[model samples]
Target: MHKRMAMLAFIILVVAWGIPSAKAACSTPVVNASFGSVTSFAVNSTASTSSGSLSVNCGSSLATIFNTDTISVRLTASTFASGTQAIMKKVGDSSGDNIPITVCLSVQNCGSPMTIGAPATTFNSTQLSIFLLTGGKNFTIPLFFSTQPGQTVAAGTYTTTLSFLTNWDICTGLGVGIGGIQICVIDQNGSATLSLTVTLEVTNDCTTILAPAVNFGTAPLLSSFSSVVQTISVTCTKGSVYTVGLNDGIHAVNGVRNMASGSNLIRYDIYQSTTNNRWGSSIASQRWSSTNATSVSTNQLIRNYNYTATLLSGQTTPVEGNYSDTITVDLSF
Candidate 1:
């Protein structure tokens, strides 16, 4: 009965010995990628750039008990970005032409293109599940590129600086308690930043050249062969100030273009106009300057060259066989 006469209770407070959060830093957080030496058509098509990493260095006590940590990477637009897309400006361009681009965690499988300005990009859950190792732990988050193609801008070097925010959480436990309970012993929560200097060198290119066969049609007399007044479609890079010319054909004696049949030849010439402005290989003065640039489904600026190919008058008509000549379509930009 004397056992109920006394009761003892003890409480202990360890303020100075409390468990503190771990330290976090991005020792090598640089994401560098390049499409390199691509054509303007490449900017209007689907392609992937080389990969880089969001390298992180961790120093914490989580490796002892929980042996794990976590992190999340989110995109945010910087000074060089506008809206949800990144604009790469062409170097030395007076027009300030911009090529819009995007980045992703995957290649062409970019279901969620990073809307960095909106800060609405999805975080990589699998990559965030970090397992802290002994001594030190290094976490690498790979970054890939997925551009928003169909941009018909100037051809040159396009570049921009892209940055992203990284968040990390270090925990002291494995986040699972005994009896299947949800345990959360977060030791640290920190954030950092990283950048990607992307370069896209766009060379001038001729994407499409639809030159139909120059058929003078069968003619009994050389002077009776009707001139060809068809259209030659030339699609080149947008903003490419260029000149289009026709090189001397395979059978060019002197300055006259001749279609050959065995030893026989049919003299002819291609002119920019029906009134005798010969479209020769000399682009310095005799070039057909670029006209208005129009876009097609391929996002290329297509220019139409209307030229007339006429059989030289007063020339002897060749033999009754098919006389053909190959002419090179030339461009000087």
Candidate 2:
């Protein structure tokens, strides 16, 4: 009877120990790992304005150690494992309490509190994906901004840094242990800027006054007249040249338009040559010159032979006729 009792006690003790061992075997192993390398991460400015997502793969090394669907890692906003999670954050510099940007993180392949397991052992074969949580989709969550009104940011390289921590709960027969993974979140910002240029051109206004036609009625015989000055006034571009017309019958006497007249009715000055009225000789003349309006060293009329005169008394005669002359002026740079 005593031997049987001792045997029974022994069996009970073995079963108690076995129960705990069985529970330990079923629990998942703990794993804390990094991205394996401090590789570069990229963010596109032109990409969706909302926060983006990425995958931090647990290559073969981390896969084999914790090899179970229950084994997993999670990201937190806090710098340390125990700190509060980093929910949505601004990715850039901010004038207020936080930086000027907003950043959010998520599991690309699974939701938060997710589990990871591998079907293969190769480094490339193992994978995990993280994405923005609620507002991560193209137009779901909005990207906050406090941009200066009426002003656009210049194009350049803008970099933002984010600190992250990943942790896992590893189960052992005795208790649970915590492990941590360190990660860096970097955002590369890009943009395009534009500049505008305007050009204007100006021109000059051309103006001129031509010689006036003169008429003389019948006058005293042997009439004569003093010379008339032809003037040209430049109203626009300075130092420009103008051309004037002249002929043998009408000549320019030192920039003057002079015409000789006869005083008698039969000896009257005729604008045009006539053989019968030769008792007195008749003559006509015109002149021309040019100058810049602004720096007119000598003031001159733009009109060719702007003014003229005729005699109509004794020693002067009136010439009857619609006397007229043509003048041409051209401007050239």
TM-score of each: 0.68, 0.23
lDDT of 1: 0.66
C-alpha local distance difference test of each model: 0.66, 0.26
lDDT tens readout by residue for model 1, 1-333: 343322211110121124433334435457587877888877778653656667666553343333345676677764345676777786566675677766765344577767675553333324444423344555666767655676777788877777777776555422434334444444455777778777788888887788898887876877777889877788888767788878888999987788898889988888885558888885466677785322233443878877888888887666699889999888878
Off by over 4 Å in 1: 1-28, 59-63, 67-70, 79-82, 87-102, 105-113, 117-135, 169-190, 215-228, 241-243, 260-262, 282-300, 313-324
Give the count of colliding residue pairs in each prediction: 1, 43
Give the true-structure RMSD of model 2. Answer: 26.3
Highest TM-score against the true fold, candidate: 1
- For each candidate, C-alpha RMSD in Å? 6.5, 26.3
State the displacement of the C-alpha of residue 202, model 2, in Å, after optimal TM-score superposition.
Answer: 3.2
Per-residue lDDT of 131 in model 1: 26
lDDT (Cα, tens digit) per residue for candidate 2, span 230-313:
343344322334433233234324433334333213222222121222111122122233431222433222222232323324
Model 1: residue 314 alpha-carbon error in angstroms? 4.9
